[model samples]
Target: MSFEYYYITVVSLVIFIVALVIAIIMNSRYYKVIREYLVQARGAEAKGQAMSGEVEVLACPRCGYSTTIPFRVGDYVGKVVGETCPKDGERLVVVAIYSLRPTEYQGS
Candidate 1:
């Protein structure tokens, strides 16, 4: 084989190998993201079941009053919520967040 032909063949093989590696790396990342989405979706479905949901604990820093409510998407600890304290009339702040299962919640 001519030296020119051999060198071109080697270079083309190297380029193909590099492209294959890059594609594999990108596909692995895509699959990772999909796996994470599926896990989150399953968690959301569990939380949507009867008496199972996430809750946020809110407190009034001024009067030390506290209450629990259903969790909202954007809620975070130390966030000031729009609801006023029933006892103190002050804005409530989120103090904690947690999930409740069917056996844990006792609704009246």
Candidate 2:
């Protein structure tokens, strides 16, 4: 092969390598931004749910049917909801109030 052909082949290889490196860097940064955006979106959803208040587990004392209600203003953990259970038309009683939040792991 001629000397000029070898020189052209080396330059082409260098250009291809540089182009591949640039593409990799650009995609990595783009994907990093997307990952951060998704994380923030999930955090926002969790925050919105937390702001809605504690979860109230209600059940009919007669039929044992259960349901959940979101706690509101002036509502306490054991406050009986103003509605009755549809299963038996019995007054629904607050069974449990769950405050769901991320906490440190405590070994059981």
Candidate 3:
């Protein structure tokens, strides 16, 4: 082959190799970023689930006295018939625990 043809072929091959390497590098970086984002999303989802599974307490609205009553989402929370407020004579108000997902015992 002629010197000119050989030089052109070599240059073209080099260019093709460089382009392939750049493409692979870019793809690897993109995948890495995507994987990290997915991991963060999964972690956030787990945290949310754990928070939803937790039991919270309620308080007497009039007396501002807190109690460690069973908490459920969308449930009416109140004092029992014999229960009395430790802080005052005020009755307990029903307060539903808030959550993204509703709990099993979600009603009075």
Q: Which structure among the candidates has the greatest TM-score?
A: 3
TM-score of each: 0.47, 0.48, 0.48
Clashes of 2: 0
The 10-residue segment of model 3 with minimum total lDDT is 74-83
TM value for model 3: 0.48
lDDT of 3 at 31: 100
Q: Pick the candidate with the highest lDDT.
A: 1
Greater-lDDT candidate between 1 and 3 = 1
The sequence of per-residue lDDT tens digits that candidate 3 reaches over residues 1-108 is: 999999999999999999999999999999999999998898577556656564445567776775543344455545332345767876666554444456565783
Q: Each candidate: what lDDT?
A: 0.86, 0.76, 0.65
Which residue pairs collide in model 3, if any?
none
Cα RMSD to the true fold for all candidates:
11.0, 14.7, 15.6
**Local error of candidate 1 at residue 96 (angstroms):** 13
Q: In model 2, which runs have C-alpha deviations exceeding 4 angstroms?
A: 55-108
lDDT of 2 by residue, 14-75 (tens): 99999999999999999999999998898577557755566667788888998665655666
Decide which is better by TM-score, 1 or 2: 2
lDDT of 1 by residue, 1-108 (tens): 999999999999999999999999999999999999998787566446523577888899999998777788998999999989978799999999887764556673
| Model 3: lDDT to the true structure | 0.65
